[model samples]
Target: MAKAYANPDVLVSTEWVAEHHQDPSVRIVESDEDVLLYQQGHVPGAVMIDWHTDLQDQVVRDYIDKERFARLCSSKGIANDTTVVFYGDKNNWWACYAFWVFKLYGHAECRIMNGGRKRWEADGREWSREPEPQYPATSYVAAEPDPSLRAFQAEVLKHQNKGKPLVDVRSPGEYTGELLHMPDYPQEGALRGGHIPGAISIPWSRSVNDDGTFKSARDLEKIYVREAGLKRRSPIVAYCRIGERSSHTWFVLHYLLGFPKVKNYDGSWTEWGNTVGVPIEKGPGGTASAEASS
Candidate 1:
């Protein structure tokens, strides 16, 4: 078995949460895309924070800027001592992403829900209909950047044809150039309707079950190790339309499997898929984007 963290350090079950709702050390954060879903109903004592708005820096580079992210957590009353239990309606992927952002900022006290809110509700967990905004005053300190935790375009290009893994979480159609959104003005350096030269395909949806909860670590290990030939120790870069989906995977690798060097290409396909000239490989047949050399 892999080295799993203690209960307080990792994903806690809905039942466990119920038992600790009033515990001052624990805090539940609802990181849903649709605020209405959380506002309408959420686990008791849970507070809402739209993953898109409340969590990320969401500008160019598509990462959580350290200073801003730290302040956001502090603003939400999350402190170094706060043991976060993050859950969301979207299979908990975004929740995991949010949890990852905090970890990137050097906060190790956070945990994401195994399945997410849907499973919690399915299991008949007690919930609330009221919303309470949290504003806490605490200082969060961010340490050195975890360079191994991310990748940039230059690094990705170097590994393109060498079979170095850069997992694309986009749909097959998008990866194959069948439905890619052509940018308004062709990007200065972009790839056409193809994926990175040596990247593999693992649609983001594969990580989550139909009900939006993450599969167990044991099952995930099988999918990753047997199917992808990747273990917790593998050097992999996960990317998607943006960095959000990949961030979800980053959390899985770092937190669930305790992988140390899994990097997220934050710019992702949104940046690569748009570059003017780059080697691309699509299903059936492939072509290097004319833009690669331009």
Candidate 2:
């Protein structure tokens, strides 16, 4: 397939990772929805970074601050210059989320392993249950969080008012207010169904192929630019049930297609749907109401 992405360096194939798994300057991190999967088996030399525990603050809904982020990097043997490659289960959903957080702290050398854990395992690669040796911790200083890449609920509301591009990367059922949560998943504290008003329903899975690797750049161009009518400079915001899934789309548009101004609304539907009197939209055709209760 033709490579059409503007910045293809942000992604690396499983083969590239296999060769560099032992490289000293490269750190392989696995972040997964099922945290215990790393203990069972993971790519050799890859350390585990739990999204819920390591990437996010325990008390607050926000991500970890620079201090905690520094601690995490040192513990993981990551330096400011380490090329961090992330891969995980669920077609790299949590992997992209972790990548987004790393970018938040301005880690400049982050990359995602294309196809994630599934593709690696499917290709008959070796996995190790033994623990990797930790390197001497470095004083990893993180840059201030880049607010430009992230969106708060207030910004989302404002974006809605402005009629800017808003991508709802959840499933069709969730986008239509038919499924209150992901199929068979818990309610996850959302008080209402439906999506933010004026959001375009573009499920994140559409960005990847059946093997979990992202589609060719031409295909992606067709989906976002041609089909969705997005421009290169369009100010776009992506969201999902809790923001994990939307991060995938954020990475694709911002990194792959080189969309200039795409931000992930991390609060997403869980925050939007619960806010009193906030507008919500239902159905594929985008009919909306003042409240999700309708």
Candidate 3:
């Protein structure tokens, strides 16, 4: 038998989703890097949440304000008490990101569909192209944004300075400063290319199987505990070029492994590599420079 996850309730199988997606008390949300994927076809009754426009603040680098978040949930027919299930393409990359955002706003009942869109498709599940019907507007009062779930640049700096565990979840190229960003994606997010000092290069994909489902808890423990030496109770932070990939790792460590404290640095490399005075280390086994440079 596979070892159980620390918080198994946070993950639901594709079969569980198929049976319960129509439950009036459950809301299925699809978020993807390719924003248009949902319009092509998605789980029936699943609503789309675009990470760029729906979750981000238009003017600032931060997420949307609490009022906007409340309006968004209400518009999506998600009441405070509704159970939210998130799944998406890219191995649920953006789905985990959307889940992180919801948690930032203190949504209590949130879960990720195991294996995401890839698994659902592989299983030959039903898909719908019809536009989702508008749900009745709900009254959703968001709790004050939780500071503990998010890490700012300064907090990340302090975390690293203290030699706490930091997981760099980007591709090795990005981690080693060989490529500024993922290949074929825009290479323009940062001026400098490298990782924060003392960060472990554990690509997010390592935690998931070829089918895009997460590895078993025993397998996960081998990777994160035996290999990476991450402790279940340690405070850790994860980051990627733009934070989406790192959010996936955050979900793994925090929910799957039951780490007591893990935060996603949303600003990530776009902010870290661009900031002039922040320290950056380049190349494999590189040393940190007090000032970042091209």
Off by over 4 Å in 3: 286-294
Q: What TM-score does each of the candidates earn?
A: 0.83, 0.95, 0.95
Candidate 3 per-residue lDDT, tens place, 1-294, comes to 228898999999999999998898999999998988898899999999999999999898889999999999999999999999999999899999999999999999999999999999999999999997579999999988899889999999988888777889888898999888787788546888999988878889999999989999999888887777776677888999888999999999889988888999989999999998988888774223211221
Which regions in candidate 2 have their CA more than 4 angstroms from the true location? 1-3, 286-294
Candidate 2's error at 69, in angstroms? 0.4
lDDT of 1 by residue, 1-294 (tens): 443431325877777888876676777888876768876888887776666676655674455577777676677677778888888876776787777666666776887776788888788877788767565667976655567676888888876645565677666766666756423323322345667765666667777777666666666666555565564555678887667778887776666667677788877777887777776777733222211221
Q: Report each candidate's C-alpha RMSD, comma-separated, in the order given.
A: 5.6, 3.7, 3.9
**How do the candidates rank by lDDT, highest first?**
3, 2, 1
User: Which ten residues in a row are the worst by lDDT in model 3?
Assistant: 285-294
**Higher-scoring candidate on TM-score, 1 or 2:** 2
* CA-lDDT, candidates in order: 0.69, 0.88, 0.89
Clashing residue pairs for model 2: none
Q: Once all C-alphas are superposed, what RMSD does model 1 give against the true structure?
A: 5.6
C-alpha lDDT of residue 82 in model 2: 98
Q: Which candidate leads in lDDT? A: 3
